[model samples]
Target: MPDRNSALRGQRIHGQFGNISKEPGVTFREIKDFSYLEITLWDWARDSLRSKLAELLGIGDLPDTGDSQRLKEGRLLHLADGSLAYLGAAAPADILEVAITPEEGCVVPLGHARCLLRLEGPKAVALLRRGIREDLRDTAFAVGQVMTTDIGGIGVLLLRPDTAKFDLLVPRSHAIEVWRWLTRRAAPFGYEVL
Candidate 1:
């Protein structure tokens, strides 16, 4: 097994750093304790791969392009490029060893390559609106949805698993930049770097 390290290890200062707008309306922290597995299914192998995944992972159908499926351990996000990301407790080794064939699909471990950040609080939607130009209204983006977009030019996989949270999966290299940008902008709303 590879060593586990945090993308925002030294960058995340555990405390409120921004303006105390109505009692800290936002809080963020790196998600380091989950497995982020990526499965890229070739066009012709989609059905077989989905079946194999269902049989091996004991999970139901993957979400549609703009949605997410919550599981017991974590959640499954359907990426824009026809890839499936399972951000769960651990990689499903059985699926890798038995289900995945070259013809079926390929697995990529994104645990370390990406930085998962949990952003939540009352002002989460409001703060995200400052950078993400998406209609985040519950009626539009609704809970259990995911989208790929950019914040300050950094590509991110934004997942709304709950009504109050927006989990951002960012490239490892640019996690801190986002942290800084978010904290600075969250000042008015009051934020915590927990």
Candidate 2:
């Protein structure tokens, strides 16, 4: 795996922050280094490339739009635009090596440009509710669901892999602001940096 060089390299990294309850209700961690590849078809609705897109990425029967599924080597997310985002520990050539002429689709590597933060613990739900206006109840936002939303006016890609876990994909430039926002809200419940 590639060495982890996080966008949030500095600032309040590891160590407990905010209210120190008997037990921390939240634990925040940055997903060190991960691969991010986006495959967008020129004409998704009716394009020959759509069929081969999955083959190129080595994913079989891609997840439904707005849903994410784990792959043998990575996690697959089907975005709202009928595109696919694959995140893994390392970048593979399956999609990267494809021709992907302009007539087919576009492949984008976003590993170095985005910051991935994971918030876990019982209070994670409550903490996220304060910023994201979306309905997060288990019934409303099921696991493996991914959506684009905003927190503190910052655009974010929200992913719910489990009940008490949420992964936020934020732009590199605004990661600190979002971290501060999360820490501030989590203070009341007590948070831990791991």
lDDT tens digits by residue: candidate 1, 61-99: 767888877776777778865588787676454345346
lDDT of 2 by residue, 33-131 (tens): 777777776764425655565676666766888898776676788886658787766645354536466666677878778889999999999999999
lDDT of each: 0.81, 0.80
Quick one: RMSD of model 1? 2.0
In the order shown, the candidates' Cα RMSDs to the true structure are 2.0, 2.3
Q: Which stretches of candidate 1 lie over 4 Å from their true place?
A: 1-3, 91-98
- TM-score, candidate 1, is 0.90
Per-candidate TM-scores read 0.90, 0.88
Backbone clash total for model 1 is 1
Best by lDDT: 1
Worst 10 residues of 1 by lDDT: 90-99
